[model samples]
Target: ASATERVHLGPTVTNPLTRHPAVAASGIASINRLSGGRAYFGIGSGDSAILNLGLRPAKLADLHEYMQAMRTLLAGESVDYKGRSIHVKWSNNQIPLVMSAEGPRTLAMAGGIADAVIVHSGLTKDVLADTIARIREGERAAGRPEGSAKVWAFAKCNISDNHDDAIDEIKMALAASGHHAFRHTLEGKNVPEELQEAVRVLQGEYVTSQHEQLGETRNKALSDELGLTDFLAERFAVAGTPDECLAKVRDIRDAGVDNLLILAISSQTDDLIRRFGEQVIARI
Candidate 1:
């Protein structure tokens, strides 16, 4: 918390199934207080965290209930659960709740309640537009003001003068898309019909142990076998010169996404961040 004290810091995601709502509230609240209220909490139905434990993601209903209960607890209010009421006396309720969602239903629910929605879909204009539409549906359903929830597009970035190298770098970052959850989101569009079988094979054989680890053996093998490295890189990452990356980000912003969380995809991490921040972010 101290290292990122001046910036907004929080877990990328937490789930209701593994951690109780009251406990989640307490932990996030502690960080908010420790960071002098600079905390932002993100929640989801669970992915690697739960999957590694052989547990399934929580249901939408459970996510909704748990998020509400967490909010109530953070506000220092007592909440009824199981057979008793619980409260966190030290909570300040200052943390902003963000929702990490991919599917339409979850995206809608997020817009209804979350301060922000992090879309894991590719940062294409079409995907951004579709994601925003779903969030608007939720906002309307909850009677919230239009555009109440800010949207963030998640993309891997490896910008450089050597465009080809930049593109190659992102291929390794494709580990994040090894799972069927991400592939299914792109089904019928970004992924072609012929590639569907490859995606299915990954759905069944994906190595959970290598989840999100760049260059993991299984991910590399699948990417090579199905030629998914280039395919996924073209659809999911931002690579090339700084100017090119900036243009892509501008388009995404114009498509209604409020922010971009660039996951640096490079062996030269420090240099990439320095150049990207100075050349791309500054220009934008």
Candidate 2:
């Protein structure tokens, strides 16, 4: 209660926490003012996070409604709820709306109402291009200005001759397939025949967080548990010397990534981040 009284969070982070839209509006406004316009709200459809809390994730319909209400209130407009338009009391009408999106529908919806979309990594070149196309489509549908919404991809970086350590770092980073990079890096687009069989038996009962594997992680434990070979995991991560690491990221840039968040893979992250930033990022 003491903590709740001192801080006003901008709605629950996911759909299941559909706490009242009016309450969300008031809280976001309060925080936005306090932060002097530095506040940006990010939200996503609840998945594992919701399940962890024993709550069911949100439906698309509900997410869309929530976004619209959030936008209206942040714009300083009192919005009516349901068919009857409800108004929020003491509305500040001055906060930014950003939605966390890694999937198609959510990306489109973010364009429709939110100011930005947080794209999860495992964002392959082809995938990012497609996702961007869909987000633009939503902007067109909503009659919003082009480039009104921004998209950010989750990213990780580690550069060293001993990048094997880096790969090892990313392996443990993901547990239960709860991330973006791990999904594509390990599982890949073409499902393997063996995994396909596993897929058959598993069907909806899928195990492992394929998305949690960083593009540069090597978890021997996870690999062995999943019956994966080093060769299997190799395709997902970028290791070897600094020169090799630089080239890997150039490909990512070529694919058209905009924002890349470098998760700390080393105790010397800032120096390494700067090293990569100055050398690799500067060139590309």
Local accuracy of candidate 1 as per-residue lDDT tens digits, 68-97? 877788889898876779989778675788
**Candidate 2 residue 203 C-alpha distance from true site, Å:** 9.8
lDDT of 2 at 256: 60
C-alpha RMSD of candidate 2? 6.5
Residue 43, candidate 2: Cα error in Å is: 0.4
Off by over 4 Å in 1: 3-5, 178-180, 183-194
RMSD of each: 2.3, 6.5
- State TM-scores per candidate: 0.90, 0.67
lDDT for residue 72 in candidate 1, whole number 0-100: 81
Best by lDDT: 1
Q: What's the distance in Å from true for residue 94, model 1?
A: 3.1
How many residue pairs in model 2 have overlapping backbones? 12
lDDT of 1: 0.77
